[model samples]
Target: MAGLTAAAPVGQPQMLTVVLEGLRSHKGQILVCVTRSADHFPDCTKDPDKRHFAVPVKNGPIPLGTVAPGDYAIAIVHDENGNGKLDTFMGIPREGVGFSRNPVLRFGAPSFGSASFSVAGAPVEQAIRLKYFL
Candidate 1:
């Protein structure tokens, strides 16, 4: 499968179209994390309820499986090495990274409010442009 969906849904099943842009290379995998928790806005490894999607580099619209209609924030990492984690050097990302709203890049990932978007019963689209800072 391309994504990890919620086990038991809360509301209607909805689809989220995540459009990744500015990919430097199509070598490895695309690791995505979706969460509504402010504390887990970017790195959601601690967010137990977070949704994960691992899609191949070549794509049209990433299939993030099914999700409940609600508010969510997304963080993406182009794992060009397929290391399963965002490889960073001196706290700076060595790979490409992006957020749902294409928030400005700073010392760290944007706050939840900056990258968050609403997922209504209808399908929603998120166009995120990747950034590389090596």
Candidate 2:
């Protein structure tokens, strides 16, 4: 009798998917920034280097998908007034914004390293809570 070998399970390439929720209203553009580099910090600030996608939201879970496997950080800002910009007051954001992992925001936005995570060999899911200020 010949011994039979078991076949290994096929691995799927990793993908990062973000589900944006708790949107009060979609008055402006939502910008999603994904990056592999965190050395310079605030990678979203750089014009050409950052991989950014802007989508219009009308209050629901917006799924951002097809992200390749790697170290990455995400930043989302709700340009609530449709000015194509984040409104801030007294060094604090007046409009809705979000970050990966949804770290507790304090005096300033969390560092890229704090929000960075590794994605490999499978799909990853993240639920971001939207923040709003009156």
TM for every model, in the order presented, reads 0.87, 0.77
Q: In candidate 1, what are the lDDT values of residues 23-92, reduced to their tens digit?
A: 9999999999999899987888889999876889975788787667788999999999998889989999
The 10 consecutive residues of candidate 2 with the worst lDDT sum are 6-15
Q: Highest lDDT among the candidates is held by which one?
A: 1
TM-score of 1: 0.87
- Candidate 2 lDDT tens digits, 12-129: 4454667788787757788777777776344466745566777887554555665555777888887778777777888778888888888888777788878887776556777778
Cα error of candidate 2 at position 127, Å: 0.7
Candidate 2: the clashing residue pairs are none
Question: Which candidate should be chosen as best, given TM-score against the real structure?
Answer: 1
Looking at candidate 2, what is the lDDT of residue 78?
78
